[model samples]
Target: MTLTAFLKDRLVYIMTFLFLAGFAILLFVLENYRYPGLIESGTMVYIAVFAVFLLIIWLAADYVRQRHFYRQLQEATERAGERDGAAIVNNGVTHEQKLVVALLQEQNAAFLNELNQYKRQQELRNHFVLQWVHYMKTPVSVIDMQMQEVLRELPLGEEAQREAAQSIQEEAERMTRGLEQMLHTARLDKFALDLHIRRRPLHEILRSAVNSHKRLCIKHSIFPRIDGEAWVESDEKWITFVLNQLIGNSIKYSKTKPGSKNLQFRIKEQNGGAVTLEVEDEGIGILPHDLPRIFDPFFTGENGRSSGESTGMGLYLAKEVCSRLGHSLTAESVPGKGAVFTLTFKPGGIHVME
Candidate 1:
C-alpha cells in the first residue's frame, strides 16, 4: 500500500538486476576477454539507455496497479465493517483479489444467517414457556375450585378440617402466583407489544392488587391500609402486577414477626405533576448487601432463602415492567424494621391511548 513497502516486496528482483549488471561490467573490464572495439562501441551505450527506460516504465506501472487494488480493498473492508453482508467493491480487481473478496462475502453471509437463527430459537423458547404456563393454569384453577367446594361442604364446627382446607388453598394460591410470575416473565421479552398505558387512579389499582391477595393477607394477619390519592400515568395491568408482587412480599416477610403486621400504601404528588406511590411493610427488611441486588433476576437473598418461597423473579419483573412503562422503582430498608418500595411516575410519562 505504500511505496516503501511495494519496493521492499520487489527487492529480490532489484537485487538480481544489480547482480547481472555488475557481472557484465566485470566481463567488459577483464583484460584477457576484453575486445579492443568495446570502449568505442556506441551500441552498448544504446542498450544500457534502453534497459534503464524499460525498468522505470515497469516500476511506475506496477506501483499504479498495486495502489489501485489496495485502495479498493480498503474501501471494501470499511463498508463490511459498517454493515453485514456488504458487497465488496471489485472494480479493477486482480484475480487473487477477487477470490479473497468472494471468501469474505461468503463468511459475512454465514455469520448473519447464524445470528438470525439464534434469534429465532430464542423467540421459540419464549413462546413455548408462555404456552406451558397457560396450559398449567387450567389444572391449577380446577384444583382451587374443587378445594373451595370441599371447604364449603365441611361441617361448621370442624376447626381442624377448616384449617387443613385453608392450608391447601394457600398452597394452591402460591402455585397460581408462581405460574403467573412465569407467564409474565416469558412475556417480558415482548413487553413493548403488550403494553397499554394511560392515566389511572392509583388507589383503584392498589385496591385491586390488594383484593387479589386478600385471603393470603388475612391468613398472615397482615392488614393493608391505603392512604392519600393521585392519578398516575402507567399501564394499569402491569402496575397492578407490580403492586401485587410488593404486597405479596410484604405479607410473606412480615408474617414471621411477632408484632401486629401492617402494610401501608400511600400516594403523594410531587412538584411538576410527578406522583410517587409507596408500599411500606413492617416486615423483616433486606440485608445490607442484598438490598442493592434485590431486583436482579433469580437473585434471592438471605430473607428469600430463609422463607424458602422466593423465586426472585417477582421484584425483577416489577422493576422491568416499571421501566418499560416509563416509571422509576426504588427501595429502602432497615435490617429488621421494614422495607419500603416506591414507584415514581413522572409527568407525561405514560402514553394515553386516544
Candidate 2:
C-alpha cells in the first residue's frame, strides 16, 4: 500500500543484497592489495550497473502487481457496500486475496438467504393469525346473537337470570373484542393494502363505537356521553377500531372509580379547520412514569397489570392506525384524576360528500 510498507515486505531480500555487496567489496579490497588495480576494474563497474538495473525492474513489477490488487480490493469493498456480492470478481491477484474475497461473497449470500427465510416464516405466521382470527369471529357472532335472543326471552321477574345472561354476554363481547384486536394487529403488517380512506360523519363513527361497547359500559356502571360533531376524513373501519379501543380502555380503568363514571366523546373544530375528537374518561389514570410509553406495543403499565385482562396492544394499534391515516393521536392524564385521548384530523383533508 505505502512505499515504506512495500520496502519493509522485501527487507530480507534487501539485507541479502547488502550482505553480498559487502562481501564483494571485501574481496575486491583483498584482491587490490595483491593486484593493485582490481578496485578500478571496468568489469566490477559493469556488474554493479547490471545488478541495479535488475533490482529496478523487479521493484517496478512488484509495485504494479500490488497496486492492481489494491485497486481490485477497493472496487470489491464498494460493491459489498451496495449489497451486490456478485460484482466481486477475481482479477489475477494472489491466491490468498482471491480466496478471502470468495469467502466474503459466500458469507454475504448466506446472510441474505437466511434473512429471506426469516421474512417468509414471519409472513406465514401472520397469515395464520389472520385466518384464525377470522374463523373465530363467526362463532363469536353466533354466540352473541343467541345471548341477545335469550336475554330478550327471559321473564321480567327473573332478576338473577337476567344478571347471569348479561355476565355471559359481557364475557363473550370481551372475547370478540380480543379477537378483533388480534386480527387488526396481524393486519397492521400490511396496513397499506387494507386501508380505504373516505369522508365520514364523526358523530356516526362515535355512535357505532359507543353502541358496540354499550353492554360493557352498563356492566361497569359507566355512562358514555357524546358532545359536538364534525366531518372527518379517515378510514372508517380503522378509526372505529381506534375508537372502540379508547372507549374500552375508559370503561375498564374508570369502572372502579367512586364518583360519576363518565366516558365522554367531544369533537371540536380548531381555528385551523382541523377537527379534534377527544375521548375523556374518569379512569384510574396512567402513572407519570408509564404515560410516555403508553403507545409502545405490549407495554402494560400499572393500570393494565392491576386489571388482569389487558393485552396492552389496544392503544398501540390505535396510535399506529392514526399515523397511517395521517392523523394525530395524543394523550393527557393525571395519576388519579382521569385520562383524555385526542385524535386530530387536518382541514381540507376530508372529502365532504354532498
Candidate 3:
C-alpha cells in the first residue's frame, strides 16, 4: 500500500499519457513547419498541462480506494495477533479483497472444527482417567478389607489364609490389567514411535494372546483354541495388544453363558493373499444397535453395564491401532450368540507406522 508500489502498478497509464503528449507536440510542430503560425505552441502546452493535471487527480483517487482496503487488512492482522483465537477479517471494497476474505473465512472455519475435535478428545481422556481411578479403587478397597479381617482375627486359619491369598491375587491381576490398559492407551497417541512392522506369525501371536488370558478363560470355564496358521506384515507389540483386548472381551462375555464355552481363533487365508483372523466367542452377544458403534470410544452398551471391568476404551484403542498399522477391524454379532471380531491384514510390506 505504499505510494511507490502503487505508482509502479499504474506505470503503464503514466507511460501512455506521456506518449500521447509527445505525439500531440510532434503534430503541432509539423503544422508550424509546413505553415508559420498554423498551430500555436502555447495551446499545445496548455493541452498537455490539463492532461497531466487530470492524470494526477485519477492516480490519487485510485490510490486512496485501494489503500483503504489494505489499511483494513493491516489492522485486522494486528488485532488477530492480540486476540486469543482465530478471526480473519477483510473489508470487501475490491474483487481481490472479496476473494481473499472468502478464503480466510474458509480457513478459519476449518481451524475451529479441528480445535473443537481436539477439545472433545481431551475431555474424553480426562473423564476416562477419573473413571479408571475409580475402578482401581474397587480392587484396592477389597484387598484392604481382606487384610483388615485377617489382622483382627488372630491365628487366621490356613484355609482362610489360602482363600485370602487367592482373592488378593485375583484383585492384583485385575489391577495389573487396568494398569496395562491405561499405559497402552497413553502410548496409543505415539504409536509410530513404538511400531515395528515385520513378518509376524499370526498363529503364534494368537496363541500367545490366548495364553495371556488363560487365567481369565479358566475362571470363566472358557477354553480357547487357535486354528489354522498364516504369516502377516504387522507390528507385533501393537497387534498383540489388540488381540489381548479381543480375547479378554470373549472370556468376560462368555462367563454369563449357561455352560462352559469355547473361544475360537479361526485364521483364514482369503483370495488375493490377504489374511483374516476371526476371534469368535460363544458368549452373550452384542445387541444389533450396539454392534455398529462397538469400536467407538467410551461406548459401553448393554453388555458393558453388567460387566464390572468394562472401560469401553479397549475396543476403541484396538481399532485405532489396527487402522494406523494398515489393517481393518470389524465386528459381527447375533444377540443370543456371541460376537466375532475380525482383524484383516494384507500381505507384503503394506503396513505403516502412522
Candidate 4:
C-alpha cells in the first residue's frame, strides 16, 4: 500500500510508455531524413509529458482502491490473533483477492470450531475431576472408620482380628481402585505420548488382570475363567489398563447375585488377523436403554443408582482408550442374566514407530 510499492507494481505501465515514445522518435527521425523538421522535437516532448501525466493519474486511482483490501486484511488478522478467530475482510475488488479472502474465511471458521470443541472438553474434564474427588471420600471415610474400630477393640480375639483386617483390606482396595481410576483418567489425555505398541499375548494379559482382582473375586465368590488365547499387536500397559476396567465392572455387578457367579474371558481369532476378547459376567445386567450409552461419561443407569457405587467413568475411559489405540470396545446385556463387554482388535490397528 506504500507509494514505493504501488509504483513498483505498476512498472509495466512505465515500460509500455517508454516503448511508445521510442517508436514515435524513430518515426520522426525517418521523416526528418526525407523532410527536415517535418515532425517538431517540441511536439514529441509535449506528447511524452502528457502520457506520463495519464499514467500517474491511473496509478493513483488503482492505489487508492487496492489499499483498502490490504488495510482490512491487516485489521482482521490482528483481531484473529487477539480473539481466537475473526471474520475475513470482504473489501477485495478483484477475483484473485476475493478468492484469497474466501479461503481465509473458511480457515477462520474451522479455527473457531476447534476452539469451541476444546473449551467443551476442558469443561467436561473439570466436571469429572470434581465428581471423582467426591466419590473418593467414601472409601477414605470407610478406611478411617475401620482403623478406629481396630484401635478401639484392643486385645481382640483371633477371629475378630482377622475380620477387622479383612475389612480394612477391602476398604483399602476400594481406595486403591479409586486412586488408579483417577490416575488413569489423567493419563488418558496423554495416551499417545506414553504408549509403546508391540505384539502381546492375550492370555498373559488376561491372567495378570484376573490375578489383580483375585481378592475381590474371593470376597464376592466370583470365579474367573479364561477360555482362549491369541496374539494381538497393542500397547501392553494401556490394553492391560483397559482389561482392568472391564474386569472391575464385571466383578462389581456380579456381586449382587445370590450364589457364586462365573466371570468369563473368551478370546476369538477372526479372519485376516483380527482378534476379539469378550468379558462376560453373571451379574445383575444392564437395562436395554442404558446399554447403548454406558460408554458415555458419567452416565450411570438404573443399576448404578440402585447400587449407589458406580462413578460411570471406568467404561467411558475404556472405550476412549480403545478408540485412540485403533481398537473398538462394545457391550451387550440381558437385564436379568448378565452383560458382555467385547474388545475388538483389527489387523491394521497395529502401529509401529521406527
Candidate 2 lowest-lDDT run of ten: 345-354
Which runs in model 3 stand beyond 4 Å of their true positions? 1-160, 348-354
Candidate with better lDDT, 3 vs 4? 4
Clashing pairs in 3: none
Instruction: Tell me how many clashing residue pairs each candidate has.
Output: 0, 0, 0, 0
Q: What is residue 282's positional error in candidate 2, in angstroms? A: 0.6
Task: Encode model 4's per-residue lDDT on 142-214: one tens digit a residue.
Answer: 8767776775665656677777777786777777778778867876766777889888898998899999999
TM-scores of all models?
0.76, 0.76, 0.60, 0.62
> Candidate 1 overall Cα lDDT vs. reference?
0.84
Which pairs, if any, clash in model 1?
A: none
Q: Rate the local accuracy (lDDT) of all candidates.
A: 0.84, 0.84, 0.81, 0.84
lDDT of 2 by residue, 1-354 (tens): 666777888889977886787688678778988988757767676767777778878887888887876666667766765666444555547788788767776787898899899999999999899899989999988988888999999989999988888888888888998998998888888987997887899999899889988877876788889999889888899999999899888988998887568888899989988999999998889998999999999999988999897888899999988877878799999888899999989765534322
The TM-score between candidate 4 and the true structure equals 0.62
lDDT (tens digit, per residue) of candidate 3 on 116-192 = 99978986885687577667777776775676666566464677776666567666666766766786786676667
